[model samples]
Target: MRFPFTALPLLALAACTTGPDYRGPETARPATPGAQFARASGDTGPQAPAAAAWWTALNDPVLDTLETRALAANPGVAAAEARMRQARASLRSERANALPSTNASALYVHATVPGLDLNDSGDSDQSGGGSESLNFYNLGFDASWEADLWGGKRRGVEAARAQLDAAQADVADAQVSLTAEIAQAYVHLRDRQQRIALARDALARQREMLRLTEQRHAQGTASALDVERQRHLAEQADAALPPLAAERDGYLNALATLAGEAPGALDGMLAAPSKAIVPLPPAQVAVGDPAELLKRRPDVRAAERRFAAATAKIGVAEAARFPSISFMGLIGIGGTSPGDLVDFDKLAAIAMPRLSWSFLDFGRNAARVGQAEGARDEAAAHYRQAVLDALRDGEDALSRFGNGRLSVASAARSKASADRTAALTRQRFEAGAATRIQLLDAERQSLSAAQSLSQATAAMTADYIALQKALGLGWR
Candidate 1:
């Protein structure tokens, strides 16, 4: 067979790609790379964040277990994982598009005709009606392949791979959010439980004061106003208990749902306070730098991947503006008799090479390319926004955590002062120097201070969880 000289240039240009290549997005960067976060205070250190499971740093066994369960069983995480699998399958399909596809077929036909003779000789001809039967059999293999002359199929595969990467990043993002939510709920639950316990203790003291006031009034020493006031204070304390209990239950149910269980499934395990106080985060948090934050944040990574995918799709669209080359082939063997089906002499083969171009679509392909470019621009903007958002999140979490630490410290000072005053009043009351009402009021102030401290600590822990999530430290 002689080679076709006219096909030389087409073969040479087959390796050429039509559209621009991806070199990573220019906008996917923090405003100040390698700079320490502006909102980080003395409480945070400029060190690379710890390993993926940052929750274990809190040193709470129950929290560690909850994180594990949420990551393993949460429906949101599972859904993200399923999407990743789907992207992978799509990538595989796109890769297969670059190769040829083949199919095999078989056919059989039988017919009978009247007034037709099955055998006829020139020496003998009959006018009488006769029936003739016929049978046909065929087997064939057909194959076709579209050549990637302008790299459209290759770009499609590239886009698919990028989409798979984005999907994987999405799964990681889900994990980050899940772990943070579980940790925050656990903190809130413990905080509410502690507050309830404190309120109950204060209520008992208030009731005792109320009883003492009533006795004093009956003895003609305390006024009726004093007794009523004591009762009102006791009632207020009692009323506070139900709301705290309700909030505690709400957090418990949230945690259970986060672990992929029913609302009350974790009640037995978490209803009671595990510790005397909510767990506090470490003193010095490792926040790394802005550059590292951008790299670690899954949302940023996912957005960048999507941008890359969009860029590849531009190439796919641009390739459509050019001609496409394809080839088809068929081979078969068949005969009238069953033995003839295997006969090489009855074999047939055909090869067809085709070129198709949509140059006269009145700028439809150009519009498609323009649309792809617009999409690419949108994805780039989204990626840039994602980067900025991640930076802001990290900074905001750091700021909240720093301020939370200050609030906790102030609350601690207030609690210490209240405790000292209460102790002095108790001493004075035992020595018969201070009134009973004075001592009870002192104790109430102390309890209020304790409640404030608990709330501040829980808020600080929540801020810590947010910081870790912003750092993308909850997934491998």
Candidate 2:
């Protein structure tokens, strides 16, 4: 009764937490034109908001298949998932520490003695008393519970739970990065294929010009210098093909690896050039503001979770300054005969309560508290940095995506103008109203314009993917 009364005060204090409680910081988007964006808004596309699987917007079946494969099998994503599982397991273990534990055991012993008291056992023989051994048996359970009077165990659970959240966020972050990289590689692949096709068309035109120049020079209608320059120009245009083909191959191999396949596995699918230019998103991208980004970005969430973990650790450290209480109990039965253990009347039991304090550690405990405080400060700084970084990435992605649309538009206009010019020059040359040089120059301009258009279109696609990555899409 006295023990129960004395423990009442400790139970009441168990609800007290010693360290500073955590409060989430306020970090809203900066107020400006378009609110969260610094350069422009709606970089994620005009028609629809960016979906979790943003790659679907490309409308390329091959790209869709590849994105699905990469997300499912990418090594980075798998590793992050494994880490999340590990963190969850750790949390379970930490939570277990706050509960009572019990263990069961059985022991049997026999010993020989030169002069033993055999009269204590009825089974001992009088003639064999000098060499007889007494048999003893014990079977019982022991239990101990460390009362969470100072909340140390609870704080450990809190920290572990925060770490688990961080790990889950890490998995989402990995998915975002992996999917974006695959999309970028796929876009570059198609771009090279289209460039190669454009260059091949230009080579054919250049060859035709070379043949016409040679024919005119033989009739003294064109100079030998013109024939030589045309031949050199044709060879130079042809020279650009191999590097683009090689780049295409590289992207194919990279995509295969990202999809967890061997190199060259996707070659059969991508070796042939695409029949048309890869598609690009329409004019307006639907991007969220920076304020929304803080909530969506996995890395930002991970940073905040780590900060929470650090805060909990501070409480765990502070708890060491107080006393610890534990209740221990044991029950067993032992005798010279094993049958005696089955009799409850012969059982022995003990219940002991203990209280301990590290008051003599002097400044050792205080130093631990200081270490925890420093860790909390460091984590808070990281959380701030994460917010700033997310904002910067969002702003940069929007700028590039918005500007990419402009570049593509300009390239399209240039290609259109060059096409009109080339067609007019060919018609004039056929009517004998323009020189062969003018027609060849016009053809060259058209080809160059076409290449620029292809590259710009590819850039737009790449920029959109980067925006999705910055917004932490594709991991849902």
TM-score of 1: 0.93
Which segments of candidate 1 are over 4 A away from where they belong? Answer: 1-8, 110-134, 273-275
Instruction: Give the per-residue Cα lDDT of candidate 2 at 272.
Output: 53
**Whole-model lDDT for model 2 versus the true structure?**
0.85
lDDT of 2 by residue, 321-356 (tens): 988988999999877787988877888999999989
> On residues 1-476, what C-alpha lDDT tens digit does candidate 1 reach at each position?
99999988888878888778999987656567778999988778889986488888889898899999889999999999999999999999999999999999897887776776555542212455776677788888999999889989989999999999999999999999998999999999889988888888788889989988999999999999999999999999999999998898889889999999999998877757545569889878899998888788889999999999999999999999998889999999887667767888899999999999999999999999999999999999999889888888988888888888889999999999999999999999999999887898899889988999999999999999988998888887
TM-score of each: 0.93, 0.91
Residue 416 deviation, candidate 2, in Å?
0.8
Indicate the TM-score of model 2: 0.91
Name model 2 segments beyond 4 Å from true: 1-5, 28-34, 41-51, 111-134, 271-274, 435-441
Model 2, residue 23: what's the lDDT?
Answer: 82
* Candidate 2 residue pairs that clash: 42-285, 44-285, 44-286, 45-284, 45-285, 45-286, 46-284, 46-285
Worst 10 residues of 1 by lDDT: 117-126
lDDT by candidate, in order shown: 0.89, 0.85
